[model samples]
Target: MPAKTKTSFHKPATWSDVAPLLVDVAMGRQKADLVVRNGRWVNVHSGEIIPATDIAIAGGRFAYCGPDASHAIGEGTRVVDAAGRYLVPGLCDAHMHVESGMVTVTEFCRAVIPHGTTSMFIDPHEIANVLGLEGVRLMHDEATAQPVNVYVQMPSCVPSAPGLENAGAALGPKEVNEAMAWDNIIGLGEVMNFPGVAANDATMRGEIAATVAAGRTVGGHYASPDLGLPFHGYVAGGPEDDHEGTRAEDAIARVRQGMKAMLRLGSAWYDVASQVKAVTEQGLDPRNFILCTDDSHSGTLVKDGHMDRVVRHAIAQGLNPITAIQMATLNTAQHFRLERELGSIAPGRLADFLIVSDLAALTIDEVYGRGVRLARNGQLEIDIPAWSYPASARNTVKLGHRLAAKDFDIAAPKGTREARARVIGVIENQAPTRALEADLPVAKGIVGMDRRNDVCQIALVERHRGTGAVVNGFVSGFGYTQDCAMASTVAHDSHHMIVVGTNKQDMAAAANRLGQVGGGVIMFSKGKELALVEMPIAGLMSDERAEIVAEKAEKLTRAMRDMGCSLNNAYMQHSLLALVVIPELRISDVGIVDVTQFAKVDLFV
Candidate 1:
């Protein structure tokens, strides 16, 4: 009898093939493809640090890991001496947005590979909002082309919030079911509509049901602090894991409710330290908790690190080194139902691991993906090709006509000299905002920004439809002391045009500047452009190299700081001004959204 035909040489072998290969390699009947010699394995399954372990690889899978692989290694087999280093499993990002890095998928992989990130579960909802299902397919296809493992999560909410906001594109239950059949799509992306879930909205439930029916995990984003009936209802709606918790109790509650607790440490979000206490102080099961970076910008990925930085932060927050590594590795894999294929250095798993010189320092000397060295000494050793999207992704910033100062003017009430206005107060390093009220003097029949009180005007331009609609409101957290404006087309969920400035002239200039350059971020101060980061791809991400994007992002940050804006990671705060899905106050194309009420409210009372 002849053997069966296989799809690919590197594909996971059937039990019969893997079982035979294991026994043959152990008995020296078959030569191993590669052998990693003399290393201390950080065994996540048993929580033991086993020294003098050898890992043998064949067909891109681990065939044997024991005291020695000398018999398995023949003249044709390659050998890599670990030199008594720590063999840690390749890091995995459980939840992340590739667009937040402001680079293409290939560029993001290139940037994080050196940091020992071997697997990523990406939510391309940003692009989904821009180009609909076609955008998601583009991301999924590009993810498949990468050398490292990059899985896609079908976007659960394209517009994010129905009725409350309108995105460039919309997705529903049909799209969810269609995406589930794709080879690269592992599950559904973050279901951001907590209100709908709590109210048993049909659309939200339908999407969740489709994901569940497909036997895939449902990502969650319950941004509200009310972990009461609403949280319980969302959990019951079938979201398997959530990363929006910012408190210790939030982590404890999620784990208690049989949902995985994902603690994120992004470039701006400082959430891990507060939530990780559930395990360190409250004595919760660490197995139910995972570490992730929900959104990381190019500057952080280039200058700092990726999952390695998150693991180090977890360790510094009073977690044991092995435990922290497990949160970023095995814990994430288990939640995604990919434990057998990844997240550990055991037999029958993909041969992906990192060689670290110091466990305490986490200094990665080499990174391996599928038994191949991808990075060495903090730089990528492998060449990853760049990918390009269709022309539809470019020139996304459609302002209808060039914006002017008059478009931002807020007309005062007929005879009103003074008015109290609802202002969106940005909370530094968090997603939620405070609904603040401020008294302002009406001048020349127009309501103006109170610069003396650090108040600035915010406007949302409908860029997708070219409606030329500018919804005006006030925001009081950037602390800008100059007559400057910051404009971006990367507004969250909706991806509309957001302009914030003290003076309307600079606002117009900044808005028009992005319009002229296709789409990107621009900072204009005193009528002169201070910084511009061109994101021609969907007006959200740049197609340039990661390092180039990081340089431009650094300039944008410095320019914001130079103009007296002092909130930490103010760029993240700036981009999220139009995110109506989160809480308290936000601006949209329709009107100023009082998210606490989940309805549009008057800017002035």
Candidate 2:
């Protein structure tokens, strides 16, 4: 039997046809598809904030925006009185990862739309790492079905660092070529391995060549801050935009090299304030700057906001409100070659906008998407379905058997009372970690964690197969107290289980909890489970609704805070334990990576 038919919305042919419809709606002679009256239009195009404006939308596009609305009140038109709220263009996140939210695409959209985010440029590299080209296509198809604009970027770095990571799937030039032909694919995802680009690696060149040949954007991820010859070489490699800029100089260099500098402010990474200085202070062109949330978790989106939080942070950093809004809206849309359909409240653009009370505070009163009111008064009005991931995507945590306390014990060199060990230090609200060496005492020829030194044991349990190979090490900066343990299967690219705790038994219990539930994040304190988010799909996202995942994540974060961990958004730092790409230190299924040197290293000295 044939599959159920999908609903198709009408698309306007040109602006000429859209203008009279706008006039008819405003004059109240013809009914509008949806009308938002008495709003202060925060027009990003003209950089003006016009008060007492009315907006008319039809066919999922803006039909009119003006002061009068007497003619657009025909029968059967859905009318929403704005009550003098500011009508700003729908926000656009220039770069992000849906997997980082720990929820599926349907859920991620539900979490952010109420916060006024109507468009996103997502890179599904995490799923691609586990399921290859099929995974990327699945995400693309799902994103196209959404009412909001969810553009997919083809995964550019599957393994991320080839020869360094053994991912579930590998993508080459063939995959890139195929993805380029997809309808919703915006461009190539973040080219993470800048070293490979500079060294002229064949795989990197081949993927970039495919994307360039397709006339699409090549996203960049130059994590290194050094603005030298290698930086120049990376720019020459054809990435048109970069979002890893953490400093003012990094932003300046990217703009100078003709690339849009994306300033991100996610849960852990507070990069926007530091990098936006290039435009606000160094006289760099504002057009070359964009705003994004590179890696926001579900909790951050539900508790705080999405691009709204980033724009507020930029404003507090002394940037003009208009400029910040522009960075998050039009600038992002232009970068992805989607300026015509989105990023503004102009005619022919998607009817997506936020009704706000104040520009500085960004107090959103209502949000509209596809000519419909999806959210109002900080709550979602539309009901989104739970995304169904294939059964093969579940039970990814194949730890063979339950983990034991002995698996977490790191044995010291023979006949040594003490040893100098390499510990992974978690830097609060930052991506780069500090490589710290500590001298610790040994017990029964094994290294022990020093509670007084804020040191805790960290274990990477191989979950891809039933290989219960647990590699143990030490970590700092969590400030976890009361013999607690936290375990998650959302460990970076590989999505392995990373457990950190001061008590050995708790570490074992935490790992076992994830194993029992298939895969998810869990916190165990004093032998009692505190919180868990069941992300059974590929061990990264849940089949549950987005709100349910957000609520669970909130509980997990609050549990962390109650455990005496005060670092802002520490959960994000916890999930990056197995990233294996960020500098200084990271853990993978293979071993701990000294990312500064791009090589694996011994855990003890």
Candidate 3:
């Protein structure tokens, strides 16, 4: 009933003013606002569980956390009997993109609260590419107004790769400095230009210098699997944490270089299983590692879980539940220098925690944020206010003109019948794509789709500038084998329209359809629309509730399956198809990018 005070979470400086009141409650001079009794405290700090623990909260913070809170309780105090359940610190997602959830920050908070994710460190570079600094400001204010802790990392790479593609907006060291002064910006977002950083490029190094000078952390994205000198050079460049490791060695190398190894298990990326082996088998310090979901679509957030899902998956992958919990909670907080703030259930910390019936299974029975009971039994108990994006933030799908089947034509050499072309080979359930080559048959000078080898057409349609420039390329591994096409404006980094189909007509239809409704994902099959989840907000996020988006996303997944595309969380793969920062090959507005070389390559070899 407390209106879920934002000052309690966002404005931690106010805690200095309120700490005296909490001290009074601890000393039994003042009555506590809320108290929990007879619970097993999963003390992440000590890596052990203490039984029959009692906690007293005042001013949305823990005043007393000991065996008994009877001295602090009074007639005005609201008591909740834990009934001998595990009292765990609320889970925290160290690194994520709120836009990846296909919902706004408020909606994302609402969806994940029931799953016991009380805190998130989000990098809004996706929106930064669309609306620039003003766009980030909108989300920052929204994040600050939430019932939970949502920290923003200033986007370090707006275009992601400098010359590879053009984003809607551009940010540099000046923008980074301006954003560092924000109340909620904990650090600079993932320094994705690993090549630039390794080479000591002025802009990339300047942004890192500014973030470090501001005394904030620098998020890392060393997508390269090579643990050689390039990786060493990047680590020396001052990125404190990295979530791009997809191998056990990658995790080991990062932690050895004094960077936090963030093990992520998003809807599509299964990096945790391979990387957590660094801790389980190699016996590295688990504290040097963190857990995160780099990107999860709406369905994963609502149907599965958030950080809770990641923690459980880690446990199932030979990690101790308490250690996995530590990886998700205290480790993350410590990475962002928030350990003394909200990662644990200690005195002087916010009363943000969870009541779990099973630690190993992570069955969250109740969720709390800043001492407020936000959810219970996998359902939200309190109201999470809705946030509306301004008109400037909507209708961002700017296609210069309607596209037709001829627009997707990939012409071959004048006299060639079959041409060897460079193709972006998608690896299933992984973030990295393979640079593949295939000989394709040419029809009327245009390259044709190879359905027998599961290859289809992938094009990046210019949406930001409305140039109507369609960059055509080939991609295999979706297993799509029908007269179907899937298009989305949720293209990573640049937020362009990525259209993939076995038939060019359907691909053109899908692109034109998104142009009509601002932006979103759509699947067109056999000359009919199968599914559409209208985002309308910068072509990335939906204004609808989390459940509605999740349902539509489910239908979209069904449509992908119906069209013979069999890849887990294929939507995530589709979105990242245009992310040129990640290797080995990707399509961009410029042309097909060979991410390994970080340069544009000829479509035909």
The model with the greatest lDDT is 3
Report the Cα lDDT for residue 142, model 3. Answer: 93
lDDT-based ranking: 3, 1, 2
Model 1 lDDT vs. the true structure?
A: 0.90
User: How many clashes does each candidate structure show, in the order listed?
Assistant: 0, 11, 0
Model 1: which ten-residue window has the lowest total lDDT? 1-10
Candidate 2 segments exceeding 4 Å error = 1-31, 67-73, 76-84
**Which scores better on lDDT, 1 or 2?**
1
Give lDDT tens digits, candidate 3, residues 1-605: 33443333344435687889988999999999999999999999999999999999998889999999999999999999998999999999999999999999999998999999999999999999999999999999999988889999999998999899999999999999999999999999999999999999999999999999999999999999888999999999999999998889999999999999999999999999999999899999999999999998899999999999999999999999999999999999999998878899999888899999999999999999888888988988777667889999988988899999999898898899999999888888899999999999998888898999988899999999888899999999999877999999999999999999999889989999999999999999978999999998889999999999999999999999998988999999999999988999999998989998999999999
- Which lDDT value does model 1 have at 264? 97
> Is 2 or 3 the stronger prediction by lDDT?
3
Candidate 1 lDDT by residue in tens digits, 126-206: 999988999999999999888788999999887888888899999999999999999889999998998898899998899
For candidate 3, the clash count comes to 0
Report clash pairs, candidate 1: none
Q: Say which candidate scores most in TM-score.
A: 3
Candidate 2 per-residue lDDT, tens place, 1-605, comes to: 33322434333335565667665554556677887888888888888988888877866678778886646666777787888878889999989999889888988888898889999999998888777898888888889767688989998887888777667788988999988998888899999888889989999999999999998999999878678988999999988989887889889889989999999999889998888888888878798899999998887888898999999999999999988999999999888887888898877788889888888989888788877777877887776654577777777778877777888888898889998999999988898888998999998888998888888889888877677788788899998776889999887776678898988888899889888888889989888999999888787888777667888988998888777688787878988877776788887777878887889899886
